[model samples]
Target: MFTRFSPYWLWGLLSIFPIFWTYLVLASSNPSIVHILVHPSGEWAARLLIFTLMITPLSMFFKNSALVRWMRRNRRYFGVASFAYAAMHTVFYVADKGSLAQVLDELPRLYILTGWLAFAIFVPLAATSVDFAVRKMGRHWKALQRWVYVSAVLTLVHWASLNDWNSPLGAVVHFTPLVVLEGYRIRHHFAMRMKRTA
Candidate 1:
């Protein structure tokens, strides 16, 4: 199946998914589009970011070379998709506020500020994700991309502080697995460094 379809097609298909959902949500008479988009897009972004981080550890844990290869080949798509959904979520937020100026005014609030900072980190990461940027930066590219983990943590903080129980509970549910996977990766990397030094 992978041999038959091009990655460009995958990109286009994934790109259309959110737009289609947005249209349907707006067409409904119940909840507003802004309401529908905010939660779904944010959750989608969270899930994609989680999957992007999982690719390496899951493959290694299962001793699956095919999983590793496939995930490595497509990791960029997942990263980009996560950013897209995040942007979509933010756009709906601004729209719900009636104007960009209102959103800016609210930026003084902690939740809004945290969310802005999270996206600020994502901006440079997304900009430098291309092949050209990778080549141009060489070794530093890996260091720069490491910021994704930071952004993910900031995103969770932003969510956890947003309200009462529901948001924090959601954060715990979504964040626990990511924390565990990253912990494993850190331990493995440290052991490898120790072995090399010894």
Candidate 2:
């Protein structure tokens, strides 16, 4: 079944879930609409970002795995989707804040500042997630994309510090796998370099 259709088509199909979720959120008559939208959108953004980052290490570890191969091909989609959800999350937050002065007033808070920093990093990365940018930037493209690591760390800090660091378990749980995989990727890279030198 998977072989019959292009990956883009599969991605399109998968995209319906987020589209539907957004529709549901927007259509709801809930009084706390901003509150309702913020957390879920942020979670989706983080999940997709993690999935995008996971592909490289998974590909390295499971060179022959079809799933990893598929993920590699669709990695850009995951990244763009993450940015889209992050955009939504930011929009909802701004709407919740109600005014520029109010928003600026909260900018000094650690959680808010980190969240904005992560979103700021995401903008350039998302803008350059294209064939033209890849060709034009050449080696520099990868260097720019590497900033996602910094964005991920900021995102972790943002999530964990919410409510004065009162409920960090969710953020810790979500990010643990990413931390472990990245650690392994670094170790594997050093090990390979050592082998080459040996």
Candidate 3:
């Protein structure tokens, strides 16, 4: 059955798997569903965003790997899916808060503030993730997408600042590989430039 559909279709299906799973969990009507889903949904959003960002450095390092090339082509799918999961996370958070006033009360907290800022950045990036926007924005599209780096930093802070900075291992572990690969990418580029100039 999987053989009949193209890889793009398969990837698209994979991208939405978390949403499907969340729906299944919600349908079960667990009383704590909002609380249960909140962390995982945010984690999925972060993971997908990491995957989306990893493509460029991985492609640079791999150079000729078909899998990396495929990931590069489908990077936007991961990005948009990241936004979807993030929206879900935000919804679940609001539901858990039970009132707008309660939610607003926590907005002054560092973690909450950073998370909202990251989500704010994601809004425009996700909105323009279409072919039409790509064509219309042309060179500017990439510049706008660069804001994802800022979002990533805010996400890291948001995750780390939870519980008064008592627990940050999960967020640190998840982001470590992306940081390493990006560092390598920068170093490699600098070395190449030096070689060219020499």
Superposed on all Cα atoms, model 1 deviates from the true structure by an RMSD in Å of: 2.2
Backbone clash total, candidate 3: 0
Q: Which ten residues in a row have the lowest lDDT in candidate 1?
A: 158-167
Candidate 1 segments exceeding 4 Å error: 1-5, 25-31
Candidate 2 clashing pairs, residues 3+ apart or interchain: none
All candidates in order of TM-score, best leading? 2, 3, 1
- Candidates in order have lDDT scores of 0.82, 0.89, 0.89
lDDT of 3 at 147: 99
Q: How far is candidate 3 from the true structure (C-alpha RMSD, Å)?
A: 2.5
Residues 1-198, candidate 3, lDDT per residue (tens digit)?
A: 323446678567766756675676669677887787788889988998988898999998788787777777778988988898899899889988999999999999999999999999999999999999999999999999999999999999998899999999999999999999999989999999999999
Q: What is the lDDT of candidate 3?
A: 0.89
After superposition on all C-alphas, the RMSD of every candidate to the true structure, in Å, is 2.2, 1.6, 2.5
Pairing residues by index, what is the TM-score of model 1? 0.88
Greater-TM-score candidate between 2 and 3: 2
RMSD from true fold, candidate 2 = 1.6
